[model samples]
Target: MLIQILLILGFVLVFAITWRRFGQNVITFREASLWSFLWLSGVAFTLYPGLTERLASFFGVGRGVDLILYLAVAIQFFLIFKLFILNEQSERKITNLVEREALSHLNEDEPASANRPSNYESNG
Candidate 1:
């Protein structure tokens, strides 16, 4: 009973944080909604573990704990993939910005005539 209470408290705290983040504009509404759903689901499962067992059997999983572990791993992998994609995109944008800034600086340091074609013909 104490553990269940603790788990519920933890889930509520996390749910509050999710909403707070959304309120502070640190996270989007969609993200907050998803997180809220997850935390609420956690609370539900903690309050009634039998639900998980029923779900597990329904899904052909041998045990409720096993189902939770499988889901946790899957969610972790999905989030990791999302982070990887975001990191790659950020790197690409940073590289492009750096290249552009370098080229602009180079142009600024050079004389205007340096970028133009020469009009004089070469004598044979």
Candidate 2:
């Protein structure tokens, strides 16, 4: 009972924090909603562990704990994949910006005529 209370309190605290971040504009409404749902689900599961057990059995899992573990791992992998894609996109944007800036500076340093092909006849 004490553990349940503690877990519920922890989930509520996180839920509050998540909303606070949303209020502060640190996170978008969609992000806050997702986090809120996750925290609330945590609280719900903690309050009624039998729900997890039933779900576990329904899914053919041996135990509720195992189901939770499997779900946590799956979510972690999904988040990691998202971060990886975001990182790759950021890298590409940075590279393109750097290339554009370098080219612009190079153009600024040289005369415009230097960038154009000369009309001189080809030497045999």
lDDT tens digits by residue: candidate 2, 11-85: 999999999999999999999999999999899999999999999999999999999999999999999999999
- Lowest summed lDDT across 10 adjacent residues in model 2 is found at 115-124
lDDT of each: 0.90, 0.89
RMSD of 1: 7.2
**Each candidate: RMSD to true structure?**
7.2, 6.7
The reply for model 1, stretches above 4 Å from the true place, is: 105-124
lDDT of 1 by residue, 1-124 (tens): 9999999999999999999999999999999999999999999999999999999999999999999999999999999999999999999999888876775566447786677443435331
Location of the lowest summed lDDT over 10 successive residues in candidate 1:
115-124
Model 2 TM-score, 2 decimals: 0.82
Rate residue 70 of model 2 by lDDT.
99
What TM-score would each prediction reach against the true structure? 0.83, 0.82
